[model samples]
Target: MKEERRRHKRLDLDVKIELEKLDEGGVTTVKYIKADVSDLSRSGMGFKSNYKLDVGTFYDTQIQIWTKEVIDAVIEIVRCEEKENNIYQYGACFVGMTETDTLKIDIYQLFNEE
Candidate 1:
């Protein structure tokens, strides 16, 4: 059996996340692909995208919560596995998020899950 390795409880979520790829040397790229989040937690989020993303790469992102609030965050890709039809499943962990941003996330989580 496969062992569960998740550190926190996650909610099944479907939301559109805004993403910007960050170059290792701080070069900005114009390549942007739309992605839809599959799940969310305090520590991480998972999404499916048609574009490929390398694991361990950090990205500047904006997640809109409940269609009313938007928070800026940075996330590192923890895992990426190919799905059917050229889709990729990307798992990312939150990084460098502020305390106020976390509280915003908590409020969004509590209200949206029901």
Candidate 2:
């Protein structure tokens, strides 16, 4: 079995999120794309998108949790793999997510455990 290197446990989730690429200077660019979140955790998330994004790049987005509260975060793409039919899977780490927002994700995970 593959060793799990993740710091936090991931929760399966299906949600659509819009992302705006950040420039080298950390400024948001006009380029926006939509991605489907496959799983989520306090530190990172996995998502799939038709639009290709570069690894090691940053993107800004707002994630709405199950409670209908939105968390604004910046994510750094750690890995990207192209699948068939132009789909790409991406792994990203939260760059500047606040502790309160992280706690919210944790709380949700606690209540929604399988």
**The candidate that achieves the highest TM-score relative to the unseen native structure:** 2
- My TM-score estimates for the predictions, one after another, are 0.86, 0.95
Candidate 1 residue 17 Cα shift, in angstroms, is: 2.0
Error of 2 at 76 (Å): 0.4
Candidate 1 per-residue lDDT, tens place, 80-102, comes to: 99999999999999986888888
| C-alpha root-mean-square deviation, candidate 1 | 1.8
> Where does the lowest 10-residue lDDT sum fall in candidate 1?
24-33
lDDT by residue for model 2 over 3-107, one digit each (tens)?
A: 998999999888899999899877779887999999999999999999989998999999888898898899999989999999999999999889999999999
Off by over 4 Å in 2: none
lDDT of 1: 0.82
Position 73, candidate 2: lDDT: 91
Clashes of 2: 0
